[model samples]
Target chain A: MANAVLTVRGIVRSFGAFRAVDEVNLDIIEGEIHALIGPNGAGKTTFFNLLTGSLPLTEGEIRLRGEVISGLPMDEIARRGIVRSYQISSIFPDFTALANVRFALQRKRGANFDFWRSERSLESLHGRALELLDELGLVEWADVRAGDLPYGRKRALEIATTLALDPQILLLDEPTSGMGREDIGRVVDLIRKVSKGRTVVMVEHNLSVVEGLCNNVTVLARGRVIASGSYKDVASNEKVVEAYLGAAHA
Target chain B: MAGTAFLKTTRTAGVSQSQFLGFTKARAIFFLLFAALIAVGPQFLYPIFLIKVYCFIIFACGYNLLLGYTGLMSFGHAAFFGMGAYLCGYAATQWGLPFELSVLAGTVIAAAMGLVFGWIAIRRTGLYFAMITLALAQMVYFIAMQAPFTGGENGIQSIPRGTVLGFIDLSSNTTLYWVISVIVLAAVAFYNRIIHSPFGQVLRAVRNNPERAKSLGYNVDRFKLAAFTISAAMAGFAASLKTITFGIATLTDVSYVISTEVVLINLVGGIGTIFGPVVGSFFILSLEHFLAPYGPWVLLIQGIVFTVFVLLFRQGIVGELQKRFRTHL
Candidate 1:
């Protein structure tokens, strides 16, 4: 197996008396696409949030290549090359698809505080931004305001922007969520294409997408991992089956 | 990389686009003539009146920078504006500093205030941000009322406009108007450049979706704070220009009433459009000036205009024009 790119150890996030993410331990292997699947409120999303540093870890630590990264701010984590896509499509609605990708590219060139200077440097980022759009099959929607794009195209644009960051490890939170079956296939293909040469950890609800694209499958239930292995191994696990289908169906 | 096909619709041939007004050679020349007309405005109109209008235009523009562009609504803009006036007045009348130094001092101090207020205010979003700014500005108002250097209720009067470069007398209204016009025009140009700059694009990203911005490796709060500082300093610069020109720094400059007026100026002109606040300033000020003969009915008329705008013309005049014409301005 590839070396562990990210290691999570007994991480806990508690709100008052409730533990949204409790004692979650995960190992995300490099150069692999890992699927995190669970029922509603299984803490999969919360766990992703903790990895990206969006939520503070209450009792454990996350390490990138064995170095601690849990308590850093979201932006700092991103700067360190751990980038994520939201469960809901998140792009700058008022900006065009091209502009959205260009803004994401701003991370490569420093986003400094110099209002007096012209943003002429941004013009340099245009070429790469368009390339990402083309790769996402969003070239036809490039000039369209992101808010006006069709749902599938908007989702494509969001992924394009995420790709613009050129992250070492990408976290996709339900990349195919709300997508039509046809669009889901397209996104799965897109994710497969982009997952090369880097690690990807996805919290996916669709098991078929997981089975088709992921190198490993980790099943979660009620804030705990029930099973983790190859798709076939996890599929046959009694606990994963019980958690997914309920005890009666299992 | 913007999908080449759809980008064609938003950006057509021979039409450049930007956050502010985008123009071609013909339009650029037309704008030049327009500037010439405003420069020679004192020839046909009262120089001080035009100066007053220009100053308010800058103030409104400054207010719009934070609200329209960055989507930050601040009701306490009066604090920066008023303090700039008071500081410039104090530096000029009390310390006998040069006009340039006095203006600089005011701008820097107001920017510093912006840093503090923005650091605190940006910790909250939307309504909370507005309220925090309002509360902070009210505190500034109270301080202005009680400050001993501010001449209590009367304010600082007879602030000499002083000579430019220690030679050309600013006492002459025409020369003063010309000097002030040069400065105001430059400030406006700077303002235009800022909104079209790279920082502005990042600011819009922050305004558009701060969460996404943060996840994209942008320190969102830092951008917000930077935008706020620049905006506050610009407001201070406008206030100083007005105080130095009018020869007085009054309590009215710092009052909440002025703060609300700045908001009205933006609302009527167009919130985020290039000429929105500029046109709004001239229009609203003229309304107040020329319509005073109608007594209390003038206020009633103003109320009607505002209500009509809020209900039907929410984008304001320039935003509407920009949308209809598909132009940047």
Candidate 2:
């Protein structure tokens, strides 16, 4: 059995009077695709924000491979292997798709500090950058400017850049959000393919994406964990349905 | 790959499979033409005027690194420019420091100041960031006004040019012009290297989407601060060069007025393009020199030019040219 790679213990984040995330706990087993599913306005993203250190934790701690990482800075957390993709497409729009992936590749090896050396000097990275791009089926879009890319290709490019870090744990926020049927299928397969060697904790609204790709599902509603199990278990959970449809409909 | 060869001729980061390494056949030709011009310019053009243009160009390019590449708008850039002048002038005039060491003192000190202010100012972003820089510059301006060594309102005057390497004579106007122009061209080349370096790529990424850069495991503020420090150091370098070339440091150079002038130069040229500051600095400085006889009407005419350019030619000279020609400038 795979061990827990990341453990969340009683994490809470509040905005003044409002509790955006409240005492949520989960164990992300190594190599398992874990889904954090919640309806709109639920704290799925806020929780992801806390986990990635994008937002400061109000209480409790998170352990990455058993070491406390809750108080680390965002980039420090990312460097320690918790890289995230934003819910909104967060690609460097002006850079070429190749450069976008190249940016992450350079950061991994701490070469972004090379101000005196020409970027061309890092030709050593091109093969690996192209390989990462090709991994996400982005090889053809490699030279295209990232902003000018179509929506589907742009999302793929973002994932390509994310994967360039070769992250130990990947946090994908709504990876297939706002996509058509065809694009969704491609992205789901892409996610499944990349999730082979590492744990993926994704905040997903699309239940089919969760069912087909995720092994463990944790349902969040009103900032609390309402359900935690396999997809089939969470789908029929009474509290989960009530949170989605409200009291009358459920 | 055969078809992509044509893209290699272009300068912009379009369709080209390789990174912009800041040089091409056209750029080589351009630099050669610049060298030829600087060599011959003193023969026909006013040497002082040419030297001033060079100084402003270097200053503007440095400012552009922060403003254009990093999207850091510092409205108080004159603090560095003026500080460079003040320190270089004092170091050379009183301390008997070599001209080169004096220049180093100016640039290094200004960069150190940049590190401190950037640490504080980067805590805020956008207009607030600009405001902090401006406030810091204002504090500098007041310090210059009250400081005894700076000579207050009268300013430091008649600073010795103190020969290159202590062996070369700089008293001759033509000799001084050649020396300043060469340094300016080298600085321009250095600026090009900076914008095309791996660090440059990361700065642009930070500009494009800082949060995304952070999510990619970069400490975003460090890049911003580093760019700020580089910009400040370069601004100081330009001012030190100017103080020696002109033989004076004054209140006007470090004042808020000069800060706005550098912005105008960048906006009028092309903010991010390779030679935008060069073209913009030449045009604005020439225009001011052209209108010098008009006395107080200089600001009014300059304002008109700025307004017309902003309205009709928003991309400035080089920016529009780069886009229209699909060429990297």
Candidate 3:
């Protein structure tokens, strides 16, 4: 197997007695689209939050490139090359698409503390931001406010902004959750294109996108990993099918 | 969506594309006109009145740096303002320091206060943040009322104007007026530079979506604290100037009423717009000047005006003009 780019070892998260994420372990390989799928309320989002340092872990540790990052703050974690996209399509809605990307680029360039320099003087960042926008096919919407973009386009912009961070690992929570079929296809293609040189860990609900795009799959049920393997191996696993059917019946 | 619509309409309206040191041409013109007025102001208006307006203008601008651009509503700004006044007053009167040194001391103290208050306040957000700041300010107010150096209830009074540098006597009101004008204009210009800089972009991003900013790897708390400290320092500068101009520091300066008054001024002048605070300061101060003869009726008139502005002019004078003319100022 290829070396794991991100390692989550025996991670546990609890809310009082609930145990939202219980003793979960994950090893995401470098340059692979790793799918983390589970039934509803399987603690997928909680696990994602723990990995990204948005929520403190109840137990266990997460490491990126062999360095422990389990308890660092969200921004600190992000600076170490782990960036994420929200399930709700988070973007700076008031800013223009270009400005949103430019903000990301500014952070990537470590210019967040540059109070004395005019924003206009950062022409290199503008060019790079535009290139990123164009890469996402959002060049036409460059000047448009993100809040005014349609839902799918907003999702695309979120990914573009995330891309501007030049992250080593992209943790996307439901990147194509609320999209139409065409939009889903477009995002799937976009994800495929962008995930070429980086590791991707996505908690996705759409089974087909997972089957088509993901090289490996991890099936989670009741906050436990039921199955982990290639898509074909995991999809045909008895426990994985039972968990999905059981969730549907319940 | 509403914010996007508002921005679209305003941005499309003849907004000047050219900027000199972050001031759009319209804003530059506004500043030029303001300077001209300052140069000729004392002949037509009371020098003290103009100084009062200038002080509040600085205060409001500093307040707007936090509440307007950063979307952090602080209800304890008077703590910094009053502390500046009291500290500068005490330094000048007790230690017999020069005007410049006292003002510098006051600004440093205010920045320290901002650091402590901002560190605590930023731990919470929205109403909780506002309440915490308000609580902190009240604590400072009580401290001021008891602290011996602050002169207790009477405050530090009869602070000397002192000589600027080693020679330029500021006993002359006109001389003091010119000094204040230069300081205030420079401060405003500096503020303009800040809001147009890369840091300001990050601040706006934090205001727009803090979580998103964090995910982008910007230390949101640190940025917020920096802005808070700068704002507090500016507020302190204004208060020191006020103390120097009036030669006194009083309880009224630090009261919660002053805090609310600054908020109202920012709101009436357009909270986020660059020139809104200046316009609001002038408008409110003018109202006060005109209504001063009416006794307690002045408060009633001010309330009525505030109500009318809130209902009819949501953006304030400069904001409305910006909307109409498509210019930032």
Can you give the TM-score per candidate against the true fold?
Answer: 0.94, 0.95, 0.93
Model 3, B94-212: lDDT tens digits are 88899999999889899999999999999999999999999999999999898888888888888999988979899999999998999889888888878877888888889999988
Ordering by lDDT: 3, 2, 1
Q: Give, for candidate 2 chain A, the lowest lDDT window spanning 10 residues.
A: A118-127
Clashes of 2: 0
**Who wins the TM-score comparison?**
2
Clashing pairs in 3: B13-B326, B15-B326
Measured with C-alpha atoms, the lDDT of residue B32 in candidate 2 is 74
Clashing pairs in 1: A119-B198, A130-B1, A139-B3, A142-B3
Model 3 lDDT, residue B285, Cα = 86
Clashes of each: 4, 0, 2
Kindly indicate the candidate among 2 and 3 with the higher TM-score.
2
Off by over 4 Å in 2: B1-22
- The predicted structure with the larger DockQ, 1 or 3, is 1
Tens digit of lDDT per residue, candidate 1, span A24-118? 88888988999999889999899988888898888999999989998999999999999999888999998888889888887778755666676
Each prediction's RMSD to truth:
2.8, 2.8, 4.1
lDDT of each: 0.85, 0.87, 0.87
